[model samples]
Target: MTATPTPSRPVWRTALLGSVAFVALLWVLEVVDQTTGSALDAEVFANGITPRDTDGLVGILLAPLLHGGFGHLAGNTVPLLVLGFLLLLSGVPRALAVTAVVWLTAGAGVWLVGAPGVHLGASVLVFGWLAFLLVRGVFARNLGQVALGLVLLVVYGGVLWGVLPGDPGVSWEGHLFGALGGIGAAAVLARPR
Candidate 1:
């Protein structure tokens, strides 16, 4: 018997599916943590980037995936969805590369200079995407992208306050560094005229 051929997927659809899958993964991890009485959180905290702690450096790679609780994750959900979807719409491979740059920059920045504590959450990535979306157009010299950036700025500008060291428990460093990483990514990835 001959097998039916699978249809090619559209780029937008693929990006949408990837974003949905990522959010689903985050929810699943949160559910597991909640169900296990936060046992998973312990692992997260243990692995979380602790400034000056050599061993905790590994958490740099894992921190974005671990959240303090569902409430924490909830705060990050919309931003992640919006920013991630926009990034992926540009192209999945490029988006992924941009994410990796932001991830490493945010994580390393936190590890190097963050306050003493376990820094965990996708907020880091969210902030990075925000920065990227806000500045990428200027570097690329694209009027459309510039317009998109302005719109994003008007909508999400308030969150920029996150970079300030205000909350005792919040990782403002991550926000600041994630933003820097985003700018960096845009600069590195911008199309030459």
Candidate 2:
């Protein structure tokens, strides 16, 4: 008997969720940055603001949902669309799981490796998704799809460099860590049974 292919989750739902959540997140980020001052700077979270000294643990995770400005948010919009679509295509639960890992992993990594002072952004999410898709395409051995993935990579992969330190206030650590998180996702979730 032929092995039945697994069914995928509804992309519509995932898209809707991505749309609503990220949009709200952007708006919230705008408000917080303006009112409380731009917490996007990685330094806010990177410092030793321990619960006793300071409390910004929340910022590391929440920063992605916020943007520094319209240009920043606009830059991420397309990537988010692609990632949301890919997750729906890959498997909603699995995609969500991967994203979560990337989020947590990237945040922690940034905290550990990021410069003493910098701001956070969605770069990690973008990095992780890029890594996840690249890994998935290779593992799947789907030539046509992988070819398309390569093209996409060529266009977007350049941004991954921005994640690295030395670019002023940009949080390279988040990018590196987030990329690792994405890679880990592919390693575990993308594994063939």
Candidate 3:
């Protein structure tokens, strides 16, 4: 008798698993940073984005993966899981493309005009994914997506103000540019193809 092949996981399940794994990685990195008495923080910031500083260019790649502390990481955890899973639900490749756009935009913007400090956190991606989810539907002209966007707007809209400069320590530049990247991604990816 021929063996029956197992069915592949549903897209939602796959997206969920991927989101969880990514969050787990962030947690692990945070643990390492904490255990080392924030030595990793120093190292990461040493190389982290310093506006207009050429030596800090590498931080554009490293910033999203580094957080100030558990408090900082925790603030981003839920948003990352929710937004990331939603983004990935479309497909890993598409999600990756969106993420890449947001990552580069946020990082480059911060590197160009951010305050004079070492900035690092996943909040940039959080803001990016939030914007992408909120606007992609409008661009795609999909009612279902529009409805979903409405729901997310109700739930996450308050955070949108983060794009503005507020706290002295906050990286609002990252948040603002990340949202821009999300909008740009939605414009490009949601086009009829």
Candidate 4:
């Protein structure tokens, strides 16, 4: 008997498109420089987003894709790639959908509980991805994966402290909400069948 060939991925094009679009969007935002403050200021969720109101909806999410500099965007690009790849491996459309829900959920929660100011950066994106990955490891009973997640958590986890407000020039609020977004994404994405 001949073995059946698996089907090609349907949404690979969309992921490619998203990656390109994300890079382009970063370039455009950098040139626009509408944060009305230092490049660093763009790190804030509200001010970083420009026009600043978020219209009370997509703002939760739209903020992460809007980065301040090449460095800031580069920071997020890898996670997007890594996490996006993982999401696609598990299931792309569902992964994207889960990410969207998590992003919005985390963003909104951050806005509500975070400090009263603008936030704009992919920090939340990073955290969300991390949470999702960590959760997956936990659920899969994969020792190596769990170890990797723990290492990531330990090395970068200190960054979480930056989310606190006491630190100067740090968007602790962004960090806080970003974490919430991540945990929320993990929960939703990992929900049982």
Candidate 5:
């Protein structure tokens, strides 16, 4: 007798699950940080990225998982879920690769040129995903993706101003570099193999 094949899940389901899991992680980390009296930002973990400091390098991996407060995390949640779900629609492996590029680029840029203070938040990834979604269609010459990108631009274009040095408390460097990373990823990943 022939065995039945298990049906694969839809890409949308996978994307939704991945997006929710990622957002949940951010919330859980924030809760732990707050409950521990902000110990994550304190001497114990010191999880924020500090410019040009050797000890602060660990933040490149952990900083995106943290935030200043619940308010901060909330501000990032919607954008993250939206952009992350769209990105993951391309498949998890590709999305992960794009994310790695943006993550490293944003963290390193902050470490190299950020102001003299600890930087922590998911904004870097948000900006990265934003830029990635905005230009990836153009890079791939996919009309559907191009249309989606245009729609996203209409919705999130105002935030692009964040790449500049406007807010003293905002890490514009992270935004700029995350965007750059996204562009670079699109050029590399969306190219014809």
Candidate 6:
């Protein structure tokens, strides 16, 4: 009798491919944004979640894929790849759902309480993945996850400071809310006992 392929084989393949594709999309968008002399910036930033602006609601969907500059995009690429890969290791469906929750939660929170201005970047997702990685193991009670979280904490813990207000023109609101969203996603999606 032929043995069935282990489910983990497919899960890993999907995680790798999806993570690459998502990061590739971020690069492509940034290339276009750069090529246009940042004309795309005005359009994207203008549409970005503006507190109390009903018309800017769509920023919740677009903001995660948009960045203000190549420098901004460059900074987010590695964390997005690493944490994103780890998140998707759980399975694409769950990962995507978590991303959607984080995206909307961060955007909405920014809209509700963020300072008045245009906020834009992939940092929201970066922060989301960071927080998710930091807490998912606890929520799921998986030793491997716990170990992975510890490793990530060592490597990326510094970024967590972004959650606090600092640096003019930086969107601490996005970081704070994205982290909160990650916590919420972890709680909601935890493995049932």
TM-score of each: 0.93, 0.75, 0.95, 0.66, 0.96, 0.90
Per-residue lDDT for 1-193 in model 6, tens only?
A: 9999765567777888888899899899889878977666656545577777886787777777788777888899888888888899888788989999899999999988998887888899888888888888899988888898899999999989999999988999999999999989988886656
State model 6's lDDT: 0.85
* Residue 101 of model 5, lDDT score: 96
Cα lDDT of model 3 by residue, 1-193, tens digit:
9999999999999999999999999999999999988877676556467788997798998889989889999999999999999999999999999999999999999999999988889899999998999999889988888899999999999999999999899999999999999999999997655
**Candidate topping TM-score:** 5
lDDT of 4 by residue, 31-79 (tens): 5555445443433333443223455344565677666566877777776
Residue 119 shift from truth in candidate 5, angstroms: 0.9
* lDDT score at residue 143, model 5, on the 0-100 scale: 90
Q: Candidate 1's residue-wise lDDT over 1-193, tens digit each?
A: 9999999888788888888889889989889888988766676456567877997788898888888888999999988988888899889888998999999999999999999888889999999999998999989998888999999999999999999999888999999999999999999986655
List all candidate RMSDs to the true structure: 2.1, 6.2, 1.4, 5.7, 1.1, 2.9
Expressed as tens digits, the lDDT of each residue in 136-190 for candidate 5 is 8888889999999999999998999999999888889988988898888898887
TM-score rank, highest first? 5, 3, 1, 6, 2, 4
Backbone clashes, each candidate: 0, 7, 0, 12, 0, 0
**Number of the predicted model whose lDDT against the real structure is largest:** 3
Candidate 4 TM-score over all chains jointly: 0.66
Task: Give every collision pair in model 5.
Answer: none
For 1-193, candidate 2 gives per-residue lDDT tens digits of 9999998656777666765576567766666666765654434444321222125467556657656666777777778777656655666688779889998888766665555654456767888888887777666666764886787688877777765567565677777878788878887887655
Query: Against the true structure, candidate 1 has what lDDT?
Result: 0.88
Candidate 3: which pairs clash? none
Model 5 scores a TM of: 0.96
